[model samples]
Target: MANGTTYKTCTCRDEKGKRLGANCPKLRRPSRGGDRWSSTHGKWAYQLELPPHADGTRRNPLRRTGFDTQEEAEAELDHARGLLALDEDAHVKRRITDLILAVLKNTKKLPDTEEVRRKARTHQDLNRQITVAEWLEEFLARKRRIEATTRNGYAAHVRIYLTPYLGDIRLDRLRVSDVAGMFDAIEEFNDVIAIERASGDPERIKKVRYRRPVGASSMHRIRATLRHALNIAIKQDRLRDFNPAAVVELPAVTRPKPVIWTDERVTRWRADYNARTDLARRARARVDVIGCYISTPRPSPVMVWTPAQTSTFLTRAERHRLHLLYRLITLRGLRRGEAVGLRWQDVNFAGNTIGVHWQITQLGWQPVQGKPKTDASDRVIAVDAETMRLLKKHRANQAKERLAAGDAWADSGFAFTDELGRPLHPQIATDQFYWIAFEAGLPPVRLHDLRHGAASLMLAAGVEMKIVQETLGHVSSTFTRDTYTSVYPEVAAAAAESTAALLATPSPSVLSHGRRKPSSARRFRH
Candidate 1:
């Protein structure tokens, strides 16, 4: 019999020939011998029934949740019946069964096998563990093979800039926002330093600080370095997304033109230098007379008397180095690297030319023999008579120094060398050049300014643009013209004058007509 109360009466007659109505509760049970049930319409109805096992144990039917009315329950039953009929063999049902089996099998702990080890190895190969520090080291190692200067720059970025802030951060986990924050911190630090320097009282230096510190150019360089590092990370698969640097805005930097001495100013400074040179020589003679003081100790006497001459000698040595550098840069228009890298073999004394084939770098004053800055920079530069004479004298002095040092001298085969014949560090030469200029009462200018000075002088002297371009070893005349064109006020004035002259002359037709007008008028009167 049905366990729950029957909501409706069945009017159909069963095998007992009794009317199935509301009062006949026994008729509510499912029929014992048939696969159907009787509905209110007196028709055979299909019902959801549990199947009996082979052992005669009946399976429990799915229980239904209570509904407000019998009709609602019947409607839910009907919908469920339709669904079962349509999806009896659905793939989802099979998948659920397979999932259950998998879960049951996986209940036991699996053994570590060779296959698992191989899979782990493959995963490691694809997604290797690499820290920012490790990647930076590898990047620097690779960069070292390219250029020494570039390698040093990369090392500086890693050591001074990157490692301090972001070294501990994992490369794979690095975010764009993290890099941006680091840049902010760097700028803050720079500002604090600037503020401390601005404060006059060095004793209370720590208290003073900049409200908005750091210049735009420094921030820009920091951004650029970060951008490059991130790019490398992306290439190495340490990063999965686009570089954060691409989205971040760097500070705007406006580089001002270098301050150089004008021709008149340079001339005055040179005149002052020559006058000092004479005065220093005369002062040395006076110091010799003061050496006769017997009461003074021998070492102390010479030191006290010759101090001025010693200072002057040191000054002169620095001046000579500066003059050599200036001639190489401004007169010959050689790059700092090329000029410093020059060797005797690279110079053709007979041909009066110098071959640019190598570069000098710091870090042990090593020479990297290679092509010039560009293909055009590799050309031979013809030396003038005065330049040749100066070079010959310089070579003689170098030879004498080499002989004096003998076995102690390092045969670096460089044109510009120290007393021991070892190649001079470019930085040392640059530093000394500036010191010389400062001592000589000249404005401080960078080594590269000499190159600009050369180009400017050439432009001002009415040298052809193409010839100047070739002499400077520029890739094209356009580059030469663009860089030095502004320095050529004389060229511009000459051009203006030529244009004016052309405009001042009468036209040939007008001139001819004017000359013949008197003759024509006289003939007409006749």
Candidate 2:
């Protein structure tokens, strides 16, 4: 290692405006007090040439300026020499060589010692030039403990939306604007999908085949994916400093409010629905336009029916093949998957309680058996006397059907199944429910909303909130109260009427025309 040279100088120009070295006359002698403050010396600076690598390659010189004294410059020079001296160690020398190679190949400037050490330890590429597609693939590969459904969802977003747009961009160089622009592009493409779906030409519609519009929910999911992926990249030290995904704007999510189908609304809707569906049948019959956009069912959110309407529906559905299935949902508040996943082992007719354990969830269109949505959801609920009666009848019917089928039974052991005794498709319950509601001239209440209506009915029947929460297997009573407190208008109206009765004026007849009601402060005589 070299001591490195320290020199002092002042700005001096010749007649040609060039600096003269120690040749300046002011440095000819020291000052009167032996002080070396000659006009020639203003400040001290260092100049050092680093040793060559073990590979015998030339290295650059390290230079520093603007030191007030020689000691200041010498101290810094010692630091430089110390840093370079570490290169003598075999491992450190190899890392230094790698840094030099990276600098040469990528035209990257030399970084500090600490930075070189980080690069060596992390083993990340010297230049962060990996594309988003490559990084996302790596991200997906490293995921091990997450559920299969979650991993599949991430993969779907990457394949369908992210790759085509952001994949080519370098992960390290991705910007907030780039993320924002991707969302904008998705929204614009959503418009295109809507337009294509509306178009009558089959060829034009084919352009968007197999594609669905990027709704607010999907956009929110995409943003979440990017945010998580980028966060992981930063956390693993694969990328540095910037997090463009964190800053991108997302649309606020608004959950749809539940609506109850009261008698008046049901009557009107039944009439309109029967007429419209009948007309659709006639029109599709004439033109054979069954699958065209004109006949597409409007997107319907969760819908529930009044208690009386619910009873009417149950009466009409009782003779159907799946009467007990609808009754359990509308009366007991079972989620669609839970109803489909019911097994004989989980049922306890003697105890009059039904145990909800396994649920059949969909990964795409394929059903997968999984635990209930939450630990609380795996519950045992008591059945009412009427419900128990209905269950007994349903069990007898199932037994008869089983006997008739003989060896043809699927023996899947599911409490509910199709006519052939095979496990029923979970969605078929919803479709058949819609058919029954329409054919029976009832309001279009979705199957899941039957669960909501069940909760409402329980509350209206003076069931305690905690008991209702437990019956529904809600994790907390507050959620049960908040979500359904207003759903049963009758309960709230009763509460209002009860409160008003307490404050009602006692007998206006006793007021005596112009009197202040004989002063409510006077003691009453019995």
Candidate 3:
């Protein structure tokens, strides 16, 4: 052997009819033949003596059999002795050698060296392979310090998509083709969703109701989860080179841009869409149909109201209980969850500021109060005097409502809530927003569009991009500028004209004056 290790091979049979190993001819004269095992035609068996454990207990010699030649059996024994070079614990080495021997005893073949090394590294079961499903579970178990909502999202991806598709693949041996094939299957599933929705028959839809392909956003999310999980696998050295999830392409996901609702479009919407019997239940179709002229998607334009229209809306909604909540969003660009998460403790009437530290999100329909969307979202924003006054009035109104409720009142302390002080569901806000928008005789805008309107209005007011970014709790000013500025074309044009006028002012040059300094530089014409 390579390390001064010794091994023995024997084929039992002797002239005296004894079956003892000492009588085997191949063992007696292994080197005398032209080839190492040419002298034997019977089954060959091999044995090795591993070093004693630290406790001074001796394990039985690793043994295996069923080879046509002694050299073949000895070659297998040499492979086990080579594994000892890893220099692990004494007992561990013996255990590993025994495992190799056990496999050899059954299959008459040595296991792959890399596979054996991985088993040693991770201390996983050598008898079974680790599958993607098992690794995903391990990944989630190790991933602490995440929000409950975030954890739920990751779990849903694993349970709903990954386990069903890629679970059986060995984690270490996953290929790009397998991931691509999985996405292809998911695409086919999308076709099924479209088919089921179009079928219109309740029975047909019920048959395959649960099975559907994912959307662009879901695909992005699942890919992100897989990429993160596989990245951890790479960092832990569970995978060596390729993160197959990293390379497989997915459909492009573009953030929807803001589109302003001009007077003409709103006129078309009120005249065309609102003039229907199903108007109350299908208010979203107002924006959906109106947006079609400008975009092909069902909900084409992410409509934002003009400053005048916004004022008109506030005037119309002034008496509504939720007006203060909508005003906060329009002025401060708070997300729905942030608005719903707002508490009286976070409101600073004295400082004229509102601290945005917590937010309430939905995991399905259950409201979960947690940290803000991002680190930047936990901010203190300055509120206008009118907005602060409005909030004070809203609080007094809520107090009166609480008094009327008498012992039935729930003191949730939320800035916006039901009469019982419970946190409002986001969908309730959505439904209310549509109702109010239609009632105000205005073009329909998503509640989120108010946030877009707020950012654009700030830009129009000459607020610095950095300040607008901070106000909106955007991670980067560049994202804030690019995303929100699309709806500010009129403001952009006005700003451009102002800049041109400023640059158009003529400044007297030395050449225009009687006295001129000597200079060799001359202007060149294009």
Worst 10 residues of 1 by lDDT: 296-305
* lDDT for 232 (candidate 3): 93
Query: What would the TM-scores of all predictions be?
Result: 0.42, 0.47, 0.48
Q: Model 3: per-residue lDDT, tens digit, 400-477?
A: 989998999889889888888778876567556666776787766656679889999998888888999999887679
TM-score of 1: 0.42
TM-score of model 2 (CA atoms): 0.47
The local distance difference test score of model 3 is 0.71
How does model 1 fare in lDDT? Answer: 0.54
Comparing 1 with 2 on lDDT, the higher-scoring candidate is 2
Give the candidate order by descending lDDT: 3, 2, 1
Better of 1 and 3 by lDDT: 3
lDDT at 484, model 2: 85
lDDT, candidate 2, 236-300, per-residue tens: 76666446666454444654556676666656654654565576576544321211111222223
Among the numbered candidates, top lDDT falls to: 3
RMSD of 3: 27.0
After TM-score superposition, the amount by which residue 327's alpha carbon in candidate 2 deviates from its true location, in angstroms, is 0.5
Candidate 1 residue-wise lDDT, 315-419, digit = tens: 454347435545767666787767888888888889898888776642212333444534566678887887778788888888899889999999888888888
